[model samples]
Target chain A: MKAVQLKDIRKSYGQNPEVLKGINAAIEPGEFFVLVGPSGCGKSTMLRIIAGLEEVSEGELIIGSETANRLRPNERDLSMVFQNYALFPHLTVEQNIMFGLHVKKIAKSEQIKRCKEAAEMLGISDYLMRKPKELSGGQRQRVALARAIVTHAPICLMDEPLSNLDAKLRARMRSEIRQIQRKLGITMIYVTHDQTEAMTMADRMMILNHGEVQQVGKPLDIYNNPQNTFVASFIGSPPMNLTAAHVNKGKLQIANKWNIKVDGYQDGEVIIGVRPEAILPANEGLPAADVKVANVEVLGTETLVSFELEGNKQWIAKWPGQWSAEIGEILQVSVDHNKIELFDAVTGERLEKTHSKKVLEVVL
Target chain B: MSLPQAQQETQSFVKQRWLGNSRRFASLLEGLLYLLPSILLFTVFLFYPLMKTLYLSFFYSDAQGVPLSFAGFDHFVQLFSSSSFMTSMKATLLFVLYTVPPGIILALALALLANEKLRGIGFFRTIFSSTMGMSVAASSVIWMFMYNPAIGIANRFLTWAGLSEIQWLLDPGWALISVSIATIWMNTGFTFMILLGGLQNIDSQLYESAKIAGVSRFYSLRKITLPMLSPTLFFVITVSMINAFQTFGQIDILTKGGPMETTNVIVYAIYKDAFINYNVGSASAQAVLLFFGILIVTLIQFKLGERKVHYQ
Candidate 1:
C-alpha cells in the first residue's frame, strides 16, 4: 500500500522563483525513501512541505490515501524528526515522546505504555526522565525518532536526522534508524545530502538538484545508471568523470586525436561518463592514453589518483593501495567499454542505455 | 648575539608591549573622562540632596532657625501623630491599590494587541508607546482640563449623552480615582513597550513546536509564553509600583488635595509641608517613609520574581 504520494508538488517563496518544481513520488508502506541533494537544492523545503510545515504552492499530497494538502501537521498524522532534533527543551525525553499523544488526549496509562515501548525499542528506556539538554546528540536523535515512532503514524518525515552527529555516531544511528523503521514498518521519508546514507539506507531514492528531481530510482540503479550528467556526477564520492567525446560506430574520440572504442553509440558529439572505479590501468580492450599523474590520495585500502586527460578534463581513478603510481609520471589509462555511459553533449541526456547487470523496474 | 644582550632585547620588547597595551588603555580613561562630568552632576543634584534629606529627617529647626537640635524619633512621632500625614499615607496606599493591577492589565492588553501578527502593527505599537514621550506634568494638566465640570470634554460629552455629570476631580470621593485613571493612562505605554519587547523576544519556534504537538494556542501561551515572560512582567510590575509611589504630579495638578484632602498623596503632602509650609524636617521624615515603603515593596517583588523567572 502506498503510504504517501506527492504529485506535481510545487513551492515558491513570495514572488521568487520556485524552489521545488513539480516533484512527484510515491513512498510505499514501510519503504525508506531518501531524498539526496546538495545544499540549497530545496530538499529540506520539500521535506517541510511533506511534514506540512510549509504550504504547498501547488500540488496534491496524499498520505495513507487521504488527500492532505489542507491538513495541518498534527492533523495529517505524520510525525517529523527535525534535523536539529527539535526536542522540546522544556520537556523530558518521556514527555517529548508523549507530547503528541497527550495533545490528542490519550489516556494516561496508554500514553505511558506507548512511551515506554518506544523508549525500549530505541534503547533509550534508561534516559526517559532526562531532559533533551541532558542527552548526547545521538540520544537526542533517538528521542526524536522515538517521538515520531510513538505517534504510530504511518508516515515519518526525517530531515537530515543524522547530520548533527559525529562520523561514527552518524553511521551507528543510520543503521539504528533503518533497524527501527524495519521493526516498526513505518514509511519513512528521509532527507539528506549524504550519498552514502542514501546508498546504504534508502529502499529507493530521489536525487534533486536546483529544485528539480534529477532522478528517482533504486539506490544501485542510480549509482549504476544515472539518467544525466548531473545525477552521474553528483551521486558518487569522487563523482563520475564527464568528458566531451564523440561516440560514433562504437568508437570514442577525444581531443580530436585519441580514439577508443566502446560498444553501442550511433553518432554525434557525446559526453562520456564513467565512475572513478570504472577506469582502471590502460589495458587490452581499448586504446590507452598517456596521462601525467598530478596527485594521489592514499586511503587505507585504496588510493585515489587524479590525472588530467586530454583537453584538460580531470579524471580521478580509484586504484588499490598496492597499485604502483608516482606523481608526474605519464601513465596509460583505459576504460571498461561496457561500463561507459554516453550522453549528448548539448542536451545532457543519455544517448544509449549502457548495458548493466540489472534492469530498473519502474513502478508505473 | 650574546645571552645578556638577547635577554636585554627580549626585556625591552616585553616592556614595549606592556606599555603599548597600557597606552591603548587610554581609551578607557577617555571614556571615564566623558562620564565624570555627568557622574559629578548626579552626585551633587541627586545623591547629595537625598543624603541631606535623610540627614535632615533626624533634626528639628523651628521658625527662629537658631536653636537647631537633633530630634531623631520626634519627627517620625510627629509624622505618625499628624492626621494629614496619616491621610496622605492612606491615600498613597489607596492610589497603589487603584493603579497597579489596572496598569498591568491595560499594558498587557495593549502589548498583546501590538504583538499580534496583524497589519500596521508597528504603527500601532508606536502610537501606544508614544504616550511614554509625554511628561507626567503635561498629562496631569491635560487630564485636569478634561475632567473639569462645566466645560471639560468628559463632562460635556457625558451631559451631551444625557448622563449626569458626576464630579471627577471636585468630589472628594472621586478625586483619587480620577488621578489614578490619569496615571494609568500616562504610564501604561512604558509597560506596554516592555511587555511587547518580552513578547518579541520569545522564540517563535516554541509556538511552532506547540502547534506541531497539537497543543492549542491558548495552552501554548499559558505554558510557554507566560513562563518565559515572567521576568519581564516582574520588571514591569516592580518599576510600575515604584512609579505609582511617586505619582503625586497628577493629584497635585488635578485636585490640589481639595475637598477634604482625599487626593493628597505622600509626595504632595511632603511638598506642601517642605515648600509651602516650611516644615522641611517633617517633610524629610515623610520622604524617608516613602523610600522605605518603595524599598520593601520592590524587595518583596524581587523575592517573588526569583521563583517565577524562567530563563528561557
Candidate 2:
C-alpha cells in the first residue's frame, strides 16, 4: 500500500472562476480520507483530478513518493468506483469483475481464479452470468466494488459510490465498505456531500467550500473543535447555536435578555456558540437562561426543544427523551458555561478565550 | 335538502349520464378522429399500393398498367426460371454484400473520429455528414463523371500511381462495384450521423471506468463501445440492408443495367421490363419478389442481431 500527498492542488475552470484553491493534505497508507462539501464545492472535481480524468491546473500529486501529475490514470495503478457503478451493461458479473485482469493480458487461468474469488467474496457467485442490467442497484454496486478490489490496487478512489442506494442499504454498505477498506488496507480518497458518511467512515475528513479548505482533522476532533464559523455551522446534525452578543468584564448580554457570567477574556461585541446537547433545563445545573419555548421535536430518543431567548433569537436544547414541554412554555435553560465558544462579532472568526480587557481590540 | 344540494344532486345525475356509460363511445370517436389522418395517408400511399401490387403481380397487364387477362402463376414461374431475372438477383446480392458491411464499418469509424474533442472538430463533423444532405441523383451524376473510362480524375490517379488505367462503369467486372462505391459514398454521411448520435448517448463514465481499469482504448472500444452501440448498429444495419436492395437511382444513372448486365439489380430489371420492354406482368412479379426479399432480410437481421443489443 502507498500513501497519497496533494500539495498546493488548485483547479480552475475556463474563464469563470477558480473551483479549487491550493489544497494540501497527506493521506497516510490505509487511510480512509473523505473530501466533503455542498454542491458545486469542487469535491468531485478534486476526485476527478486524482483519478487523472480531469487535468489539474496546478499541483504536485505524489503517489507512493512519485510525482503523479504526468501519469495516466491506469499508469498510476489505482482503481476507482464511480457513483453510478458504471458497470459494463453488456458484460456478465464475472467478466465485469475480471475486466482489469483481461485488459492487463493476465493468464487465462489467473483471470478465472481472480474472477471466481471476487464473485464469491462479493456474494455474487450466483449472479456471475447475469448482466449489470439484470441486477438491482445494490448488487450492481457490489459488482463495482468487486471490480475495484480484484485489481488489488494500493490506492482506491471512490466518488460517492454509495450515494445511489436507498437509506437502509446505504447505512449497511457504509460499514461494509469500511470493513473492506480495513481488510485491504488501501488508501481510499472518497468524495461525498453527506456529512454523516464523511463523519462515520473517514479516518480524517476535509471540509471544502467555495474552493477553499475550511477544515481538515479527525472527524470527532473537527466536530468538537471547529476552526471557524463555517465548520461550526456545518459539522453537527442540528449544528451549534450561534447568536450575536456584547461581552464586557464577566457579563454577557444577548439581545438584552439572557445575561451570563462568561468571563475570561474578550470584551465588547462577540458571537456566542454552543451545541444543542450542551444546553440544559434551568434546574439541571450550569449557567441558566429564562426562555420561551418556540417548538419541540420529539425524536424517539431525544426531544429537541427550540426556544427564543429574546424576540427573534431562537436557541435549541436537546433534552433527553419523553421530557415534553408545551408551546410558549417559559422554561429556564442553562447554556453549558464550559462549552461556550466565542467569536469576533464582525469577522466570523473564533476568538481565543484569553484575549482580554484593557485590550481595545479583540483579536479576530 | 337545501336548494343548492337539491340542484347539485340533479347536476351529478346529468354528469354521470354524460360521463359514465357514454364516455367509452365518445372516447372511441375521439381516438378514431385522431387516427384518421394517419390512416388516410397509409391507405392511399402504402396499403392501397401494396394491395394493388400484389393483385397486379398475378395478371398479365397492358402497357398502361391495367390488367388484360389472368396470367396466374405463369409470370412468377417464368421470372424465376429466366436467366435474366436470376442474374438480377445475384447482382443485387453482390451489391448488398459490397455496400452493407463496409458501410457500417466506415460509418462507425467516421463517427468515432468525430466524437473526439479537438479544435474545429465540428467543422470536420459537418463535412463528414455533408452527404446526408446530398441528393441521390446529384451524387450519381458526380460519381458518373469520376468513373469515366478516360481522362477522369479516378483514372488519372491510377495512372499517376503507375497502375494501369481501368474502365470503371464501362467494364462488365467493375460496373456493379463502381455503382456500389457511389452508393456507399452517398450513404456514409447518414449512417455516420446516426452512429454519432448513438455514441453520444453512451454514458461517458464507462470510458473513464475503462481507463481506470487499465484497459487500452482499443480494448474499451471493442468490449464497451461496440456492445453499448449495438442497438444503433442494429438499426443502421437493418435500414442499410433494406436501402441496398431498393437501390435504383445510382445504378440507373451510372450503369443502366449495361456492361453485359453485371449491374442489373432487381429494381433496374423491374424498370426495364415495365417501362423499357413493356413487360408489366413480369415486372410486377419481380417487384413482389423484392418486397419479400427485403422482409426476410430485415426479419433475419432483427432475429439474429437483437440478442446482443443492449438498449441501455
Candidate 3:
C-alpha cells in the first residue's frame, strides 16, 4: 500500500463556487484519516473523488504514486462503502461480499475462502445466503464493509457508512471499523459529520466548512487548540463560548466590567473563546462574571448550564457532577485564564503568544 | 345467587344481544351501500355475461340470441374435433408466438433506449409510447394501408431495395404473420410504458455499485437489471398473452380470416360462429375455451415469475 496525495484539488460544478477549494493533503500509508464537516460541506464529494467516482475539476490525484485523474473507479483499486450501504438487494450476503472477486475473475474456491474470511471479520457469517433485505440496518452496513474489504484494496473510502444505524450501533461500528482498519493495515479515508466519530476514529482529521479547509490535525490537538472560531465552535459538543470584548488600558473590558488584567500593548476589540468545561464557580475574590442561567440539562454525571453573558449572548458551562443551579439564577463564574483562546475580531485568526506583548504585571 | 341480581344479569345480556344485532345490521347495510355500484356493474357487464356464455355453451342455441334445445357436449366435442377449429387454434398459438415474447423484447429495448439522461430524451420516450393513445381500430386501419402490397410504403421500400414485393395481408402463409406484426406494433407502446416504469423503479445505486466492482455493462444488465425487472416483465407477459389470444379487430380488418382461413384466430372463429354461421352454442364454447387458455398461460407465467420478482 502506498500513500495518497492530493495537490491543490479544486472541484466546482458549472459556474458555482468550488465545493473543495484547492485542498492539498498527503495521507501516509496505512493512516486512518477523516474528512469531517457539516451537511453539504462536500466531505462525501471528497471521498468520491478519491474513489475515482468523480473527476477533479483541477488538481493532481496521486494514488499509489500514479496520477489517478484518468483512471476508472475500478481501475483505481479503491473500495468505497457508501452512506446508504448500497448493497445489491437481490444478491445474497455471500454473493454481495464476493462481488469484487467475481469481477476480477478470481478462482471460485479462493473467492469463497476470501468471502468467508471477510464475513467472519464482520460477524455476518450466518447470513451468507440471505438477501440484503432480510438483514437489519447494522447487518447491511457490515455487508457493505465486507464487500469493500474482500476486495483487499489498499485504500478504503467510507462515506458515513454508519449514519443509518441507531446511536448505539453507530458507536459500536465506529470502533469496530477502526479496529479492522488497523488490523488490515489499510489506508482509510472516512467522511462523517459526527464529531464524536471524527474524534474517536480519526488519527488525523481535516475539518471543512463552506468548501474550505478549517483545520487539520490530531483530534485532541484540534480540540484543545482550535485554529480559529469556526474550529473552536465546531469541534466540541456544547462548543466553546465566544463573546466579543475590548482590551483597554491593559485590562480586559467585558460588558462594562474591567476586572481581569494581563499586560498587553493593544487597545483593540477581540473575540475570546473558552470551552464549556473550562468555566468554573468563582473563587473567593477572583475576577468573575454574573450570569443568569437560561437552561440546565443534567446528563449522567455532568450538568450543562447555559447562561447569557453581559452582552446577552448565550454561553454554556459544563459542570461536573450535580450542581444546584436554578433557572434565572445569577451566578458568578470564573474563567480558566490559561485555557482561553483569542482571535482577531475582524480576521478571526488566532493570535500567537510570540506576537503578543510580554506580561509585566497583573494589575489586580 | 340473589334473585334480583340474577334477573338483572339475564336482562342485561338480552339487551346487549339486541344492541349488537342492531349494530351488525347497520354496518352490513353501510358496507352494501358502498359496494352497490361495483356489484351492479360487475353483474351487468362482467359476471352475468360470463355465466351466460358458459351456460350457452352446453345448450343448442339459434341465431338472434335464443336457446333452441339441449346440446350435450356436442358443440365442445365438435370444437375439439373440427379441422377448422384446429386451424384457428393453430393460428392463435402462432400469433402468440409471433407477438407476445417479441413484443415484450422490442418494448423493453425501446424503454431502455428512452431511459437515458441525455437531453431531450423525453421526446423519444413520448414518440415510442404515443401508440398507447391509439385505439385498435385506428391502428388497424393505419397498418392496413402500410400492408398494401402494390402502393404501400412497405412495398415501395421492398422494390427500392431491388427485391420483389411479397404479399403482406393476402397470401395464406404471410397473412397471419402480417396481421400479427401489426397487432404487436399497436400493443408495444403499453408494454414499453410498463417496462419503463419498472426500469425507473430499480435503484440506480445498483448500477453504480456494479461499475465500482468492475462488472461489464452487459453482465450488470443481465444480473441486476433483468432480475429486478422480472415482476413488471411478468405483468407485461400476462397481458400480452391474453391480448394475443383475444386478437380480433386487426385480423378482421386486415385479414378477414381469408386465404383459406390461414389467419382464422379463435376469436374470429367465435365471431363467425355467432354472427356469420348463427351457431351460438359453438361460439360460446370457443369463447369459453379461449378463456381457459388465457388463464392457463397467465398462471404458467406467474408460476415462473414468482421465484424471480424481488419486490424490494
What is the DockQ score of candidate 1, to 2 decimals?
A: 0.32
**Model 1 docking tier (incorrect/acceptable/medium/high):** acceptable
Off by over 4 Å in 2: A14-16, A103-106, A244-252, A260-271, A286-294, A308-316, A326-332, A345-347, A355-364, B1-33, B148-151
Model 2: how far residue A127 lies from native, Å: 2.1
Highest TM-score scorer: 3
Sort by DockQ, best first.
2, 3, 1
Writing each residue's lDDT as its tens digit, candidate 3 over A138-228 gives: 9999999999998888999988888899999998999899999999999999999998899999999999988788999999999998999
Pick the DockQ winner: 2
Model 1, B218-277: lDDT tens digits are: 777777778778888988888888888887777777888776988888888888888788
Ranking by lDDT: 2, 3, 1
CAPRI quality band, candidate 2: medium
lDDT of 1 by residue, A33-71 (tens): 999999999999998887777899998988887898988
Q: Tens-digit lDDT track for model 2 on B55-149?
A: 98899888888999998899999987899888999999999999999989999999999999888999999999999999999999999888887
Fnat, 2 decimals, each candidate = 0.27, 0.85, 0.59
| Cα lDDT listed for each candidate | 0.84, 0.88, 0.87
User: How accurate locally is residue A172 in candidate 3, as Cα lDDT from 0 to 100?
Assistant: 95
Model 1 ranges with Cα > 4 A deviation = A245-258, A262-270, A281-287, A293-295, A309-313, A322-332, A354-364, B1-50, B61-68, B113-120, B133-146, B150-163, B248-261, B267-273
